[model samples]
Target chain A: MAKSVVEIKNLSKIFQRDSFSVAALESIDLDVKEGEFLCLMGPSGSGKTTLLNIIAGIDRPTGGELHVLGEDIATLSEDALATWRNVHVGFVFQTFNLIPVLTAYENVELPLLLTKLSAAERKEHVLMALKLVGLADRIDHYPRQLSGGQEQRVAIARAIVTDPTLVVADEPTGDLDAYSADEVLDILSRLNRDFKKTILMVTHDPRAAHHATVVRHLEKGQLLPVEN
Target chain B: MWRLVLKNLLRNKRRSFLTGTSVAVSLFLLSSLAMVYTALGKPLENADSIPIMMVRRATGIVFPMPASYGARIREVPGVAACASLSWFGGYWKDPANMFANLAVDPENVFKVQFASTIPPDQLEAFQRERTAAVAGRRLAEKFGWKVGDKITLLGSLWGFNPELTLRGIFSGGPDDQLWFHWEYLNEAIGRMNVVGLYWIRLEKPEMASRVGEAIDAMFRNTPNETKTESLSAFMLNFIAMLGNVRGIILLIGSAVTFAILLIVANTMAMSVRERISEAAIMRSLGFRPAHILRLFVGESLLLTLAGALLGIGGAKLLYDSLRLTQIGQFAFADLRLRPETLALCFGIALSVALLAATWPAYRAARTNIAVALRHTG
Candidate 1:
């Protein structure tokens, strides 16, 4: 009964290399509803990240009508798309791509800098996000000072600090050990169930998919039927 | 944003310090050379206001002229005062401690060379005593000479040593020269009625060239032909004897500037290359390309600004501490760094910052976010 937060129809992506063209995604039809944890599973080079990037407005599709939150994102300019992403979407990369120069507290405050928030308001939001990830004590610690699990948690805090409408993560736990991987998954699952945040994740781990409400497979850029 | 810039610079402390030191040293050398150049050309800035002229032998300044020509020069139209200045190249203690000791006509020297001011009592004492000498304030301070101090100079040219009493100390003019009675030198050198050159003061500044031409024409075709020129042109000729000093300073400054530019450009390029992945990560976080560019350029700007401060400040500190108003024959009476020079150095620093950061920042900003991320991964 939840409203559709994302809608894609007949989407295709082609990459050109010199004189040759390679299709990354073809005839992709997908819909993600609000408050749904949608997991995208695929082998290597299955256009999983490419699809995720397109949804997050980090990349443009070659052909399709793509709408997220009822806006025609494919028609937006690059600058406008970036602004929209800043306000509406959050991202978690596999490598925990937090700026090494910034502390954990400052890293979480990065996206808020783009907003019209005052200094007091930004600090409030950053502190709340770090506290949500149980990293209030390590707020002043740099990325190099933290463990792998703590770094991923800090990245998660940075992703959700702005309270975006959708959080798209590409293998958020792909580099973590089993214990750290479960910790990251538990946070992502908690963000979905408790905060009602819509999450679209790309993963190769079957165990990660087990935490998703709906899991879809993509083999050679074609989407298979959803598995409940 | 500034915090980030600071942190990034501190990330590579060694590289940043080396780059900054290079900029500091280069700018220091450049500004010092520029100050020297400015000092050399300074007299020309107010050349029109000074109505003094110099008349020497047509052949060269070293060639002596007839001291009797002083009276003829004084009779010329537009001539206010004329004095004979004979160079008594002498050293105080050691030949290495050489300075300009001149035998000047005590009666007309102050009238023609009025830039050097002395107290009324001191002026009278100087003209009354035959072997009296009036040293410049700086010269007196340098040699620790006081009134009634007896100083002996060993002449380098005439093989005569004169024991002179320091009667008074003058305050201005080229404050590094010592002047004594020309009649004393004439008596000491076997009554040779020969003079080195004549210093002529004009009724008006506009009369300089005409009076110089008139003086030269009067002595033309004689046994001792004369060449007369305005004071500024005379000083320029003195500088020209050093062989294109301005050109040499400019060349050295330009080379130093170019070398610093290349060094800073290399530092910025390396910094940007190392952070290419970080730039893409920010881009994915919805930071615009222009923002990324600003961040990179901001880092470079801070770096160069630090260098400029160190360089300009260090130059001022070192020069002020040294207080070297005179070096050899060059007199930099007011040798502080000019405001224009400071502004110029700052402008150079800003320009270097912008030029060095533009290409690297542009390349990093415009790179495709997906490709950059994937390549780094």
Candidate 2:
């Protein structure tokens, strides 16, 4: 069996909003092995993004141990969790949440700024990351100046610039057109197969699931059996 | 991050400029006005040993006291010297050109009040020449008067242009005054010999209050009963006549501070509101809460500090170049920005920026990343 990069046991999440209690996740027991490409599929309000967020350490699991890279992320302090997220995980969002003011190079260099990399090394890594997304020439362009496809590409470059252990993408191509979406999905598949990154993606599109090694179904706050 | 801060400030030009200009203008006014006030008080501050008490009528400083009191105060044991002066309020060439001129005892003028401030040779020249006048260097400089230059005073309160010869120019005394023989004024006023006030120096500093009381007690129930106060007390009384200046200025400063604080704070809060998503994005990018706090607050401080430097430097250049002297007959005083005022300007800038940025920075830093992301998501 492959080494498990993530292990979850009976995880549950309850959200309290103004005298209303809603369960977002219930009794989720799962494992994401090293170098595995897992895709979670569901309709709206199905907690697909919530599950990915829990694995990314940005959202807390309410009632179970969530171990990522063999460490219990639930037990970490808020700041330690931040450091852990910085060093170990990367995220690609539905909206290409690039800081509009920063250039593509600066945006891609954002995560690595927290590291002890020298300026020269940061420049090299930023250049290579943008090169990977085929945006090396557009590094000086601001977000508003970039096309939607190019902006999402820059977002992907920023996500992997620090070479994190796990990359969690939530609808990474949700805002892209067909051509752009194919380009982004192709890059994700390459990162998983060629670079051996453990990718956990949340998407409703079957075309996105085609790149995943295993696709699971999430419905009504419960993990269903594998769809494919 | 500092680069990001600079870019954020530039992203919204109008709000940033308005807040920065508000801080600039308010502090410019505050610092410049306070500097003028401080300059006005400088003479008194430096007059540590004014050396004499002024005796005035109990009614007011504008009222005249009996000239006979000069002789009586001389008889008092502690009174070492005495000189009586009547104000000679007249101008040459233009009534707008105003300076202090006093009809005083030329023989004892240098002895009682202005001793050692004038040279003995100049005092002798002033005494020997009957129409001789000793003018302060500033007044002489204003009118281009030198020794032996006969300057005519027009519209004297006694109704005569007393043609006085400038016997000497005194540099050590007040730069905006003149002293001449009382004999000329007495004769001009039909030998009335009445005076406005007497300047009396004590034999010892400790004898001031006792001698003052003794002098007033001797004149009790008399028609022109007097009030004798030390020089510092007289200066304080004059300042009190200006009517709660310090209190009013403090109130104005506080109001300006509160106003700027609110304006800048509201601006910063609005900026944070608009960037709620960006803040979450920063956190998701591994920024700790402290980072966000420092970024927002530091941006505010940078904007305010930039404005402070510009305003203070502009005020210094303007005032230093003009040395504004046209403040309603206050010809001798000038407006100047000191080093201390510069420090105060930047200090107020930094403090108010911190005050304005505190709430916004705290709220932005403590923002829930999940909720913020949902708002943006």
Each candidate: RMSD to true structure? 3.0, 3.6
Tens digits of per-residue lDDT for model 2, A76-167: 88788888888888889998999988999999999888899999999999999999989999989999999988998898898899898799
Q: Candidate 2 at residue A19, lDDT?
A: 100
TM-score of chain B of 1: 0.89
In order, the TM-score of chain B in each prediction is 0.89, 0.83
Q: Compared with the true structure, what per-residue lDDT tens digits does model 1 show for residues B252-364?
A: 88898888889899999999988888888788788998999999999889998899899988997888788765543533555567787788888988898999999999999
Please name the candidate that would achieve the greatest TM-score relative to the true structure: 1
Residue B107 lDDT in model 1? 94
User: Which regions of candidate 2 fall more than 4 Å away from where they truly are?
Assistant: B39-43, B49-60, B63-82, B88-95, B111-122, B128-132, B146-165, B186-233, B324-335
* Candidate number with greatest lDDT: 1
> Judged by DockQ, which candidate is best?
1
Query: Candidate 1, B279: how far from true, in Å?
Result: 1.1
TM-score, candidate 2, is 0.87
- Tell how far residue B37 is off in model 1, in angstroms: 2.2
